[model samples]
Target: MSQTRFGNQIKQATLTPFEKEVIDGCLLGDGTLTKSGKEYRLRIEHALKDREYVSWKFEKLKRLCISDVQYVSNHDSTRFGTVGHPEITVLRQKWYRPVKQVPEDLVLTPIMLAIWFMDDGTKHRDTVDISVHSFSEQSLHLLQKQVSLLGIKTTVNSDGKGKRLYILKKSYPSFKRLTKPYILKCMERKLP
Candidate 1:
């Protein structure tokens, strides 16, 4: 999808208050609905800095169960100041879904498999790094803390190399129902 088209889709897609604000800030300006055409970095930074922003977006996206969020990069610099020229191409937000079945030899949980799918999917593999190392042990710890804070009960393996594994003792039916929207929200908050 073209950048303009993707931007339009973000504008038209149903979003939470936080999602709307972030997208609007990126496509438009902070206080205006008119397209700024150059605020991608600023908007992304703003959204990431706000804790509620990312959480809200993630929840909404997971609920929607959207396969991806596509957009284009208009900036010339990386978010981390790397020497890279941003391409004016589609940016996809790949969603993670638990695999119902896998080979018995592979000791992986549904969540782990889902995360793998999101990172390995051809559409986003080149654009985003979803590798196991990318997940980070620190991030997993943070996720565990967050999940606890949110009152979501699950058993997470405390020992792991990079991304720790989390196994829900009592499966939440609601989780399946909310996966789409939750993922979308996550992308909104996490994506630049």
Candidate 2:
């Protein structure tokens, strides 16, 4: 009964399998799961124009959130955060070691890739670019390898800012097919 109340907070919120999938996708993008002592909380922020997107995410993980999404006037962004949870702490520890890195044991799923695409993917003339600038060269290589396991091929390129994984033109069909099912309607504009 402890977690039954509509607005009541759980002492140690347990994440659902779907929620874990959400977190994994977010970690690959800009979302931060911060650790304090033994607890970790996920914070999601996006442009005010993306309020609907963040709201969608909020709805998916509402059980862990104590408050509704907030508008940050300074950044002109919408943001929300989850309450601390030990389950989240485990993920943070696995994905972050001083700085974010691709988890060695990661297994990408369609929904997870869709979330990541919505977060960082951009469509080019004949390719898709997923910004992985924050990751080291080694981490990016590992990510490329992981993506290949699904039969999609990609290459890492570096520009003025940093590295990004470019889904080759030939693989666009496969990429689209794999991620389209999980792509949110609001983010369909990003696809070719």
Instruction: Give all candidates' CA lDDT scores.
Output: 0.30, 0.84
Best by TM-score: 2
Model 2 residue 73 CA deviation in Å: 0.9
In the predicted model 2, the residue pairs found to clash are none
Residue-level lDDT of model 2, residues 17-117, one tens digit each, is 88889889988997998754457889999999889999998998888876899999999999998877777888888888868998888888777888898
Q: Name the 10 consecutive residues with the lowest summed lDDT in model 2.
A: 2-11
- Model 2 — TM-score against the truth? 0.90
Q: What is the Cα-based lDDT of residue 28 in candidate 2?
A: 91
After superposition, candidate 2 runs with Cα above 4 Å error: 1-13, 35-38
C-alpha TM-score for every candidate: 0.28, 0.90
lDDT, model 2 = 0.84
Per-prediction backbone clash count: 27, 0
Candidate 1, lDDT over the whole model: 0.30
